[model samples]
Target: MHRFANPGRFLRLAGAVLPWLWATALAVTAWGTAWALLYAPADWQQGETVRIMYVHVPMAWLAMGGYLGLGILSVMSLIWRHPLADLAARELAPVGAAVTALCLATGSLWGKPMWGTWWVWDARLTSVLVLFFLWLGHAALVRAFDETERGARAGAILALVGLVNLPVVKFSVDWWNTLHQPASVTRLDAPGMHVDMLYPLLVCAIGFSLLFGAIVLARTRSAVMERRIRALEMARARRADRPLAAAPATLAGD
Candidate 1:
């Protein structure tokens, strides 16, 4: 992990891996979408509407997974002072928030047909909404301070603090009576979902994770380059501000 602290090395590694990541994500997502929508059998209960699960479940997983990543990065940044960690966390926030919003939106769309409503105060839904707000709050905090270091520290703290919401989001369905169903793919004994539905979902989840990684790496690399440029410009300006060395006094005798 410390090896990746150097932005140049990280950038090189990212460059090498990005193409493969993007290709895998695209290929898997395409295959999963086709399988989920076209070939997978409809749910016995929900029928055609269950197709939305492919997109919704993956987005929800990534939404929570993204924040979990952010929290870990924040810890690395704050405790170990990892140079790239804060940048990665900063880049990840918006992506997590976007996915969280999509989760809510798709869940709502799925709900309207099955639950007979577009919105609900269910524990799972409410907790996820809180997670989304936490992401927004972290983003705002990261930009709020005039000093970048201060902002980063503040954001890191916010991120760590917000981790309390993660378990709530994960276990809300079990802890409270809600319209949302309990865990399907994750179970102590065995997955509740059928193999037909589960396979495509697993594929889609992997694709989403890859996509998230690619986006974060790209954004972090951009941030590092921008910071490097700013540092160079500052160096140039400092040099420009210095008085030109006094011309050496000419020796008339020479």
Candidate 2:
């Protein structure tokens, strides 16, 4: 991990891997959508409306997963000073936030027909909302300082601090009397979902994860290039300010 901290190495590696990652993501996403929407049997309760879960559930899963990834990257940045770790965390913020927002929007859409309301202050919902805000906060904090390094450090600390919400969002249904249902997908006693439905959901989840990775890597690479350009510009500015040597002819004349 530390060796890969070198930007050149990182970029080369990413360039090699990104093509495969994107291809896999697109393939899986397409197959998953078809399987879930066309072949998977409808829920006994929600019927056709249950198809929304195909998108909603996976995005919700990725929302939390992306944050956890960012938090872990933050820890790595602070502890090991990995050059790209802060960039990774900073880049992950908007992607995670977008996914979380989608999760909420889709949830609300699902909720309207199922729960009879567009919004609720229930445990799972509220914690997920907090997760979105945390992402926003992380992005804002990282850019709040003139010193980019300091801002990155401050943002990393804030992200680690917000790690508490991840578990809360995960177990909210179990820990509280909420409107949300308990884990159907993740259960000790066999998945509450049939294999037919579960496979497509899993495909979609994996696809989303890969897509998130591709986006984050692309963003981080752009950030690193920007940083490099800024450093070069600063160096050039300093060089321009230096006094030039007087000509020998002028010295002789004086």
Candidate 3:
């Protein structure tokens, strides 16, 4: 684990793997979309509107999963001082927030036809909204301080505290009376969805998960490179300044 934490080593592995990840993600996601949108059996009750599940369900799952990841990264940052953890978490939040927002947007689109409204204060919906805000908050807080370490520490703390909401979001529908539907894909006894629909949904979930990883890894790589460049520039500037400082002392001595 420590071996993988080195920024240089991580960057090398990411570069080698990212192309494959992107290709696989695109192929799988396209196949899943094709299956879901065209061939998969629509719900007997909901008919064509059920098609939204392919996109919305994946987004919903990713949103929660991403937050869980952020929490883990936070734990790493706080406990082990994993060198890359802070940077990874910092890169992850915006992507997570974007995914969460898509979940909310897609949910609204799905809900309007089913529930006859664009918004609600239901437990599940509200908890998810909170999760979205938590993502945004981490993203913002991490950059708020001038000192990067201080910002990272603050963000890690916020991420750890925000993890309490995960269970609440997961169980909200079961725990409270809400228009939002219960878990179908992740049901304990058995999946509630039909095999045909379920297969494509699973494919989409896997594909998007890959895509999420690719995006985060790409962003982190860029960040590492950028920071390295800035450090080099600062070092060069200091080196150039040293000559000027020495000249004044030499002239005073003369």
In terms of TM-score, the best-performing candidate is 3
- After TM-score superposition, the amount by which residue 139's alpha carbon in candidate 1 deviates from its true location, in angstroms, is 0.9
Q: What's each prediction's clash count?
A: 0, 0, 0
Cα lDDT tens digits, model 2, 63-159, are 9988989889999989987768988888899999999999999999999999999999999999999999999999999889998789889999999
lDDT of each: 0.90, 0.90, 0.92
Stretches > 4 Å off in candidate 2: 240-254
What would the TM-scores of all predictions be? 0.94, 0.93, 0.98
**Model 2 has how many clashing residue pairs?**
0
Where model 1 places Cα greater than 4 Å from the true spot, the runs are: 244-254
Question: Higher lDDT: candidate 2 or 3?
Answer: 3
What does each candidate score in C-alpha RMSD? 2.9, 2.2, 1.0
Superposed by TM-score, candidate 2 places the C-alpha of residue 149 at a distance from the truth, in angstroms, of 1.4
